[model samples]
Target: MQTIMYGIPNCDTIKKAKKWLDDNNIPFLFHDYRKDGLDSNLISQLYQTLSWDELLNKRSTSYRALTDQQKESLNEKSASLLFIEFPTLIKRPLVIHQGVAIIGFNQKNYQTFFAV
Candidate 1:
């Protein structure tokens, strides 16, 4: 399968990930969830590789902006809805490589993950 990185274009981490891919000559496709909109099938695929704790960007301003009630009630189903409604709430660059989802970018991890 083709490598696909999902995140907003302006995100610093996304920028770094893209640069690393380009520098290593690793071909990939960037999916701007902010523009393209997230779908349940994609969300499910991500969940297959990682759990809610791993996928949720709790530190994100978009997530912090949620009402206390929303935060308190978060579960896989509810969180999925929130993620769909707010793409920024999900972790940056949920990279799908070889049918696995890598939640974030790290140089060493990328090297190993991509086997570069």
Candidate 2:
């Protein structure tokens, strides 16, 4: 199975997800969005499966720091632009398998979805 995990290494959720995958002997690649740039196309694709509200991290300081105009006027295009500019603005540990884009990591969700 071709799986790609995207997140910052220091994130606890990412750490736990990585550990879970490791324990299950799941082979996957890690994509550090902070190091490697996030693709606009990938973000757009993710948007198709997950809404901007789901993919975008509204809780992060990066998102919170946005001006009122940016926050209020947020659309798919604007959200995608923010994600490309600040990967940290994305929710942690997005996992991709086949054409499936998994948003946030959850123990039950991971188990059911990834079968790990």
Candidate 3:
């Protein structure tokens, strides 16, 4: 299955995920969203598959720094805008394997998804 991994290069979770993929021999294209910049269409596509809540990293420093109004008034469009402006606000290591988008990293999930 073709896979693409999206995240900031310095993210610890992303590092772990990349290492796991490497160790398991899973080849994937790594997209550094912070450096590469997020495509609006791709963000829309991910939003369609995953909830705004899922895509939004509420635990992120960026998220925490948001005004209460910004956090409380979140909807798809607004959240997308926020994510486009702050890539770190989106979760790390969003993996798309064979067109299936998986958010976050977990060894067990990777094992099951890749069947490795």
Candidate 4:
């Protein structure tokens, strides 16, 4: 299956996910949002597959740093804007495999999804 992993390079979860993929001999492309810049269309596509609440990294420092109004008023459009402006607000290691969008890393999930 064709796979693409998206995230900032320095994210620890991303590092672990990459290592796991490598160890499992999975050949996939890595898209560094920080370097490549996230397209609004791509963000919208992902949002369609996974809702804003699912894709957004609420636990991230970026999310935590948001104002009360921003947090309380977050909707699809606003959240999309935030993600575009600050890629870090999106969850790390968003893996798209065989047209499936998997947000965040979980060893068991990867094992089940990839059948590795």
Candidate 5:
């Protein structure tokens, strides 16, 4: 499978990751969730491979805005649905490299992931 990075287009981390991939001569497909839309299958796959704590972006404004009730009631299924409903709640630039789900970006992690 082709490497794909999923996130909002304007995200800084996404921008950095994109630039890093390009700089490294790594070819990848960028999927903008806000423009291209999100799907349950991807979310489900991520949920299965990783923990909810890894998948959810608790630091995002979208997640921070969640009501205490909503936050308290969140579970795997509910969090999955919430991520689908508001893709911003999901972590930035979820990089799918060689069919593996990577939740965030950093130079070291990218280097390790790609062995660059």
Candidate 6:
């Protein structure tokens, strides 16, 4: 199966998820959005599966620090653009395995999806 992992390299959650995949011998392509940056098309697909509410990390300073107008002007296209511009604004460790996109990594979900 072709699997792709997207997240910042130094994120603790992403570290744990990557370790889990490594330990389970699951082969995956790691896309460090913070470094390599985000793919807008992929981000759009994620927006379809999970709402912008779940995809955008409102907790991040990037999101919180946006001006009220910037926040209000964030439509689907703008949201995706913002995420590509600010990868940290998106949730961590978004795993794409066998065409299925997993937003946040959970042990049980990972186990079931990867068949570990």
TM-score of each: 0.93, 0.88, 0.93, 0.94, 0.92, 0.85
What is the alpha-carbon lDDT for the whole of candidate 6? 0.83
CA shift of 19, model 6, Å = 0.3
TM-score of 4: 0.94
Report the lDDT tens digits of candidate 2 across residue range 14-114: 99999999988889999888787688887876776678878888889898889999999999888888898888888888888876888777889989988
Residue-level lDDT tens digits of model 6 in 71-106: 989877788888878888888888888777787779
lDDT of 4 at 8: 95
Model 6 residue 114 CA deviation (Å) reads 1.8
Residue 81, candidate 5: Cα error in Å is: 1.5
Candidate 5 clashing pairs?
none
Worst 10 residues of 5 by lDDT: 44-53
In order, the Cα lDDT scores of the candidates are 0.90, 0.85, 0.88, 0.90, 0.87, 0.83
Give one clash count per candidate, in the order shown.
0, 0, 0, 0, 0, 0
Tens digits of lDDT, candidate 1, 28-98: 99999968768898788778888877888999998889999999998999988888899989898889998
Task: Let me know the TM-score candidate 6 reaches against the reference structure.
Answer: 0.85
| Model 4 agreement with the true structure over 1-116: per-residue lDDT tens digits | 67999999999999999999999999999999978879789888787678988888989999999999999999999998999899999988899998888878899999998997
Best by TM-score: 4
> How displaced is residue 114 in candidate 1, in Å?
0.9
Residue-level error in angstroms, candidate 6, position 103? 1.5
Q: Pick the candidate with the highest lDDT.
A: 4
Error of model 2, residue 37, in angstroms: 1.2
Residue 50 displacement (Å), model 1: 2.0
Arranged by lDDT with the best first, the candidates are: 4, 1, 3, 5, 2, 6
